[model samples]
Structure formats: structure tokens, C-alpha cells
Target: MQEEFISVWVRDPRIQKEDFWHAYMDYEICLHTNSLAFNKKSSCVRRRYSEFVWLRQKLHDNALLLAHIPELPPKNPFFSLNNARQITARMEGLRFFLEEIVRCPVLLSDSCLHLFLQSQLSVKKIEACAEGRSRYTVAEAIQSSGCRVQRFCSEEHSQEEGETDSE
Candidate 1:
């Protein structure tokens, strides 16, 4: 049998709530694995950033035999939090972190990261988000494909214009 691989990425993070205690942000994760145990499953899940950190901290205690796991993007005040730019960058960083873990044979097999990738959001977390009672932040990473498609069409039009102008 061909070797199976795992892939994971984060996307579409938005500010779910900005209130005290109940404040939260949410994002989507896409995971694919072809392992026989996992049966080549692919799934997407919604999550809050805090849940991600909780998973990261849990991994730290068990990563002694593995290479350095990538860091989770910080929720620091260095840049404005809950903004499109910050949220996108954080999601991008998380995407990188997961990609790194997947690339490593040992780290990729780690149960903690796999659980984080494939597990559903806990009931408590879902209820907490529902109770936050705040509006969703409109900003999220505009997917790269949509922008690339638009740019490609515009470039082709400009090229056609250039050809006519030269003639």
C-alpha cells in the first residue's frame, strides 16, 4: 500500500465575540489523512483560538521525543487584535504550524495534534460561543484563490490591450 499522508490548514478566522470573559474568535480547519486507521478521511471543523492554545499547551508536555513543534500565533497587543490583518496572519501562521507538524513523521503521528485536528469542538466551547452574544467580526482572510482568479483575468485583459496598442 502507498504511504498515507496527513494535511491540515486553518482558514476563515473571524472575531465571534469581543466581550469580556465570554469573548472569542472562531476559525475553520480542514484536515485530510489517508491512513487506514483514519480511512482516508477528510473533514473541516470550526474552532476558537483558545481551544487551539489549549491543544498546543497539552502537546508541549509530551513533545520531548519529537522535534520542536511550531508555535501558535500569539494573541498579543502588538498589533490590533480582531482585525482582518491580524486574524489572517494568525490563521496563516497556524496553517504553517500544522503543515510543519504534518511534515514530520514523528510529530505527525502524535495523538494530541491528530486529536486536535480531527476532534469536534467540545460542547462547552460551543455553548460558550453561543452565550457570548456578540456580533461576528466582518474581517477574515479573503481566500487566496478568489483574488488570484480576479488578478489573472485582469492581467490577461491588460495583455490583450498591450498587444492592440503595439499594433
Candidate 2:
């Protein structure tokens, strides 16, 4: 797999209220392909930029909620217990978010073509073999096929080479 450049931006703002506290964290994940423009005719570049913006907004809302919101876990009787629980929950949320984000690139990119013809032999060599070629030329052609096919060809050729060696 080719290398991918990943950039992450995180912002955390803590707001303390008399009864509770709220913290908002935002994250932006980007991929760089070293192209000035993805496609001149299409809006793929603009769309990617927009996705980053939307992700930041969504994370801010989910992470930095209102202090009084009932959706958050209730405070524990023991301060240490409450703090520990909150920290644990935050870590879990971050782990889940990162796992989800990591999958996006692989799923979004184009990997289908490589999957289809990965085992194919080159067309030119096959044509050359069909013509009147020397034995050595044909043997080299077979050796340069896909890795699995090449292995089989080499093993067969070794048997022939061994017989010649003995004579």
C-alpha cells in the first residue's frame, strides 16, 4: 500500500459551571495526495474540505455538550469515582471515534482494479511465445508471469534442467 499523509487537529475548551463542567473537543482528519486539485471538472476536492468542516462541527456538539444536559452520566457520590468514570468514558469514546475514522480512507479509495487483474500475466510475452521463439526465450517468458504462476513454471523447468544436467 502506498503511503498516506494524515493530519489531526484537536481542540479542547473546558467550561465550569457551579454544578457541573462541560468540555468540547474537535478533531479533523485529512488525507494528502500531493495534487493541487483532485479533479478540475468535478467538485471532489470541495466536497472533501466540506467533510472535514462537518466532522469538526459534529464532534464539537457531541463532546462539548451543555452542562445541564441529562444525557451525560450523573455525578457519583465519591468525587474520585466520578472522575475516574468520566475519564474512562471519554477514553472509550475517543477510541471508538478513531477506529471509525481510520476505516474511512480504505473504504473510500479505489482498490477494486488491483484486486481484479493482480494475478494476470502480461499480454506481450504470451504473444511472443505463440510465435516461433527459441526455447530459452519461451522459458524466460513463463518465469515472468504472476508470482504463483511463475513458481509453478520454475519448478517444472528445474525438472527439465535436472534431466539435461544428468545427461
The best candidate in terms of lDDT: 1
Please report how far candidate 1 places residue 107 from its true position, in Å. Answer: 2.2
Model 2: lowest-lDDT 10 consecutive positions:
39-48
Q: How well is each residue in 1-167 modelled by candidate 2, as lDDT tens digits? A: 54332221121223223355633332221122222222111110111122333333433443343211112222334423235455455434433443344334432221211111121223333233434342434434333323333443343444532443122
Each model's Cα RMSD: 12.5, 25.0
Off by over 4 Å in 1: 1-4, 18-21, 78-82, 121-167
Q: TM-scores for all candidates?
A: 0.60, 0.22
Q: Candidate 2, TM-score vs. the true structure?
A: 0.22
Q: Give the deviation of candidate 2 from the true structure as CA RMSD.
A: 25.0
- lDDT per residue as tens, model 1, 1-167: 76655556577666666566555677777765566534225556677777777766656656774667678888766655447888778888777767776777666555545545654536343223334522321111111111223443343444433443122
